[model samples]
Target: MPVSPTDPVSPIDPDSTTGPDSTIGTAAAIAAATIAAAAAADDSTGTDALPYAGGNPYADYRHGEFAFTALTDLADRRLGGAVLAANDELFAERENLLLPEPAEFRPHTFGNKGQIMDGWETRRRRGAGTARPHPTAEDHDWALIRLGVPGIVHGVVVDTAHFRGNYPRQIAVEATELPGTPGPEELLAADWEPLVPRSPVRGHAANGFAVASRRRVTHLRLSQYPDGGIARLRVHGEARPDPAWLAALGTFDLAALEYGGAVEDASDRFFSPPANMIMPGRSRSMGDGWENRRRRDEGHDWVRLRLAGRGVVRAVEIDTGYYVGNAAGWAALYGRDEHGAPDDWFELVPRTRLQPDAVHRLLLPGARPVTHVRLDVFPDGGIARLRLHGSLLDD
Candidate 1:
């Protein structure tokens, strides 16, 4: 059976108090248990692998305040199916570095060349004697990636899992904006701005760096000093919708990520990312949806979405595709016009029972405009997509 994105690994207790004192104590306990468990697991497997059970392990500990979530990966494929171009990859392929799943480890594994690795690994560079890919190349291996969404980036995560001694000592990130399908040569020539300055990175860990830039970017360049391997690259930030595209399209799915819609907040992202609910097209698998941990409390799990633009919601689609057994039992829809302060909330869809692996379309009753929408799932489960089909509000 194919892996369902919403497969439950960790169940959360919604009734637990989340006060500051309780939160701190819980965090400390969880951290201590995680460390001990990881140590024990590593000793047997000879690999450092942590469970992505409840929350994001990397963001929880290493991310700090700027640690949001990664918006780019193979799951979403945000950059219009952008390709990865690297200077060298003698051990592992360059494309594996952008996989959505975390890097894997297998001890005592070797291929025709040597030890098989999961990430993009280049051959050893013995000083200046190493043959350069390009004549004017510097003493570093670089990879170019085009973002699926062209927007302002807030941060990046350079995960170097499974590579202890071969991981890059230092890494730098740069980005640029270019319209249409530009060749690699054109992309390389365009002016690139520093997103993350050259900084030391540790192996077998997620090294996150906060990017502060107002300019919208479409492409990124990752440089690893000398030569080494990197597992994955996660770029997270707000999506900037193109005005011209919206103007031409007129009416569209306001909840779509391609249109700039975003999941402002969510009760849980344990099984799958909440943002996946707003992505374009039907979810290919159960993993491509908004999934929450099973709740055992009186309250329900909910996710708030900021629409691409203010619009009048005429029809709504709630698809539970590929979620046959673990679909939400019931759901409620709410909408509000206010962006920051949502004081006036109107019920769009009253709490209703939902069928498994099916589509529910409802024609909204009033014609009131809504800038944002919230989907509340009872007891917590998975929802493939929540679409608000409406016409854009005239500027």
Candidate 2:
């Protein structure tokens, strides 16, 4: 049954009418109500449901069209960080754009240059008449950022929050790949491909664009028409890990995001992203982990992760760093082979009491290879990271 957004309540009663029109109407209404209720609930809890709505002035901003949420941020500075260089950063720092923390708004945070902003801000250009350090430089600002993990970029988010009037009128993105560490001049000379065409952008909002490239890239170039400020840049994509690197490391964390692992499913993403549980390093704060709403029912919350590679599990590390009182009370683990049926899942760890803001390392009884793992948390609470230490199976 298809649901119409306008009429959520059914008009025809099942007991009173059995006509074709009445039956259709009843089903449609019920479907509409169910969808609306689910969307409303997800939005209220700040979970990743549908794309963000409200306050965006751009009429062309389509919801859920951009692949921003599904992919990981390859250019995130906190994930090993990236090397950033800019033509000019007279007003603010360029590296702040890739910071893992959300842009801050400190009313009185200033420096000798001027009012310090938590973003990449350049001095306004005064045209060719003004003397400049680079006489032949173009009449625009640009920044180059090397991605922490080289991968195929699926989309980008140019967050210009708090940069209202000072935001760029248009923005474009380009990507490139090169061997070894290259200097600024060499990076600029490499053949760059367009990921996002020059397009109009709105201020004080997240501007998303779907990239069309399938080529793996290691660096990105952001060009803003003229000169302005940009708060953040998020390049989302699937990580294409180096095969040789994985071979050298041998046994590693199969569920680690840096190694291409991902959260396939979760009971809920109400408070924090489930993918955070597999991200590199311990969570810095309570908000930097996978957290769900407290459960009132008999069932508990669980998250499924695709292993980075087929591997025999030897040990596991469940970290509840920073969760404290909100951490899960108990947890269990399950695993299955790639060709195994859903019901064929086997237990890896039995349900055990979990200590708040602590680490639990459990050695498995056997060295069974698994392609996926499911972590079940009793009731509902936060988990910082799930480390599955295992030796990779030869291809």
Candidate 3:
């Protein structure tokens, strides 16, 4: 049987609310529990080991502890590669590659509405509903996908459906990354080879793109021009597991909360569909309290709330909407307790700020628990939403 990405074999133990007094011990315990569970479920596989339940296998499958059944199941779902929309220079984004909705790509039915664009003009060729061998210059379509398990992204897959005439002269996989970022903005990791060109394009059947090197890549691109039919595309890849902070970040009724001194549903007002509950905004006042400085662009306009009751918080997730300058510095997001005292002395958490039109998931580890969160704008910018999840108790 194949494993569906939506389901989890076992429910996470939510009852254990460990806090500062016992966090170290609790972390150790979780690690131990995970290892023990993996060991019992592991099956000997020459290539790599599967995780206990095998939904998201470990990076090195060889040492994984799940069963062979799990291993095979994971491979099947992850077998096909993603289809990419490429550029003339064979570059995905930097070289004239773009998406319809770059910041809100969710990858599901509702998420697929966005389109990819390559700066090329082609005559639309008609199709007879039969699968062709390659794409032509007229048809314009491509996709990007990650490979391997959801968390352990190893590569990408690109399939050029039916291009100009169902045939293309060649197809290449290009990697991209942010400028001046330690690793290649487009390349997955260091030592990545230039785009791989495919000869004899096949319709429907996909082309696999292995990662240049192992890196937790945040972007990807593809370049393809058809020699002949119309082209449709499909991209497949890893699904990132819920960020670590989510485990500790408990849920709060954000829709019923107030923001910027106005009663509103954060989700609908800020985030796109599905993740609507996560909202971001700026405020001079927090629930009718004394007003803080009200600067329209005072950085950190977004905020996330959680109900921790009496426990202490240890982590948070800040979703910076695209503009890296919006999150220019580390002091944008802050926290406070019931008495309005700054939690943890308002220490700043370092982050790789998000770029314009890109979502940057910022993780704040070792954060202290507080009843309220504050977005302190240094050079306030477009902060659409924020999410804080985790427990507030000593392990």
Candidate 4:
């Protein structure tokens, strides 16, 4: 017989400032100086943002989260992830599983089947109905997902947001690596390695699970006990691309998602993630890039990224496409070897002026073997893409 389920920062970049209005760019020196003076007057040094003290249950309720949430979401649709198939979607569609937007709800929005929901949902099962006990194994609804950046998954988050009563009683996850694009039929019988065993989950909360497998994975299967809805699914981990594929591309972007490059850390993410600038294709709009809040306080912003591998970058493209007024006024690039000391960074591109809504590509001077690189933007602003053209060195 099945059992019933239970109901249950980052760094201190002190000189950061979003200003009163978020639209203010970092280039306004006078405004920036004033804000900096005010910040220092209060003796407010760098400290992480704090949660509201009380009376905000919506923002205060702590959900089940793991340290791996700090990693990139490899299953993001912007990175090419897709929910290929599902056993059922009677109430909601599977495409919503990887939506970048947060799950939304309308109190009375109704469809032919029932209340409309922004998530993947399945109908009540026959055996799981009032007739039989909830079976623990092989009696659940499942969905298959193709990962955007194939890698050894570190952890996963099964978001049940806005799914209070309809949330699953239990959840489990499994992953496998497949070549090219495998259809749902081919994936059904493929060897799948379990990442998360079936476990109880709390309603309307983010349920996190750390994956133990170090093997490269290209897809994931999420199982919800019996029947229910899941708002979103996030798989976080370091990307590991195939060396053979990199060789075939000849000259390719050294800092790219499809090629295995990743953002290791960043000085800010108030407006957008740094990983956005390293996506597979060009940006379509202003929001399709890495953006930081205006630097009204002090200092500049920087993002560090690990390359596909140690290689000699021959050229670079610092695209500010679509960023008209908020583009960085000046920028610089630095490179470092993988085995070098953590603080040992060498200049690849000295500070240079930048034009708004333009693509800046310059041929690099030297051939330094670099495994990682850092891009620094003056004050703060948005950047659509950063491409380092180079060939990977043979290991």
Of 2 and 4, which scores higher on TM-score?
Answer: 4
Choose the strongest candidate by TM-score: 4
Stretch of 10 with least lDDT, candidate 2 = 1-10
TM-score of each: 0.79, 0.79, 0.27, 0.82
- TM-score comparison, 1 vs 3, better candidate: 1
lDDT score of residue 370 within candidate 2 = 90
Error of 3 at 94 (Å): 11
Per-candidate local distance difference test: 0.70, 0.72, 0.31, 0.76
Which structure among the candidates has the greatest lDDT? Answer: 4
> Would you give me the overall lDDT of model 3?
0.31
lDDT of 2 by residue, 1-395 (tens): 01101111122222333332122212123223332332332112221222324453333222222323345678877565464689999988899888866565555567898777878999877645546543233467899998877777767778776665687878999999887777789998899999998876666556666665779988899998778888888777767677688899998888887887866556666777777888788888887888888777776777777787788889999999999889999999999887556446789999999999999999998787798888989987999989999878895
Q: Provide the lowest-lDDT 10-residue window in model 1.
A: 1-10
Clashes per candidate, residues 3 or more apart or on different chains = 4, 0, 90, 2
| Model 2 stretches astray by more than 4 angstroms | 1-67, 108-110, 130-138, 340-343
Candidate 1 regions exceeding 4 Å error are 1-13, 16-66, 70-81, 129-138, 339-341
lDDT by residue for model 3 over 69-129, one digit each (tens)?
A: 1111111212222322232222123222121111111122222222332322233334546
lDDT digits (tens) for residues 331-353 of candidate 4: 99999885666557899999989
Per-residue lDDT, model 3, residue 329, is 34
Q: What is the per-residue lDDT of model 1 for residues 1-395, given as tens digits with 9 covering 90 to 100?
A: 10111222233345545321122212123323432332232223322334434443243222112223433232235435354578788999888766656666666689997878878888876644457433232568888887776777766767777667788878999998888768789988899999989987766666666665768888899898878888777776667756787889878888887777876556677878776787778988998888777666677788777787888888989999999989999999988887545566778999989999999999887788888787888877899988888878884
Candidate order (lDDT): 4, 2, 1, 3
